[model samples]
Target: VFFHNALPFVGFGFLDNAIMIAAGTQIELSIGVVLGISTMAAAALGNLVSDLAGLGLAGYVEALASRLGLSIPDLTPKQADMWQTRLSAHLGKAIGVTIGCILGMFPLLFFGDEEEKLEEKN
Candidate 1:
């Protein structure tokens, strides 16, 4: 059960591995599965990871753009969601998954509970 919680970390590592695995292979496998999805319809079978990533990136981009006085067309929630899909779809699997995977792992570094460290002290 303890190791199960660590799955998130392992999952994110695989996510970013697309960059190392060669761009050509990204099409061959679904985004989440490590063995690589063998089926021809891998993209459709993949999770909504691009949308999640798009939302994360969009928030950061919007914030920076605001500071720079650059305008974002759809600040509204509904429109912003549509924008996220379009952006992620345009980004494609190779680039989108790589960036998203790295970002996904970033929060774990600062926010996750240091349970292992506590165990070591006992």
Candidate 2:
């Protein structure tokens, strides 16, 4: 049950964080500079993009999880409805997402700060 909930969310968190970071860096370097928007504003726009992409890609994420052979556990309806079961699933998802988001921060390693570069030039 934990794996069933956790695995797919790992993918979701990875995608969400990766896209947000990549897009935010791009926007900060380009549109944010041109329009004089703050880095935070660029990040907000990047989050918007990530959210829209998530809505479109949710099915694909689920399908990929299925392909990985994680099926729902064969619990009886009563067992599935137990509080312990629910708690395990929730904990699994939270932990999985945290791990995935950490992994997704790999993008930050590749991007340099454009503002720093500009400052050095001046």
TM of each candidate vs. truth? 0.27, 0.93
Give a tens-digit lDDT track for model 2, residues 10-80.
Answer: 99999999999999988988898789888899999999999999999889999999998988799999999
lDDT of 2 at 27: 91
Q: List the residue pairs that clash in candidate 2.
A: none
How does residue 26 of candidate 2 score in lDDT? 89
Give the per-residue Cα lDDT of candidate 1 at 114. 39
Give the alpha carbon lDDT tens digit for every residue of 1-122 in model 1.
11222233334444433332332234433242455455334433333444454445555643543565544344466754686655644454445445546654443443234335433643
TM-score of predicted structure 2: 0.93
lDDT of 1 at 44: 38
In the order shown, the candidates' Cα RMSDs to the true structure are 16.2, 1.4
RMSD of 2: 1.4
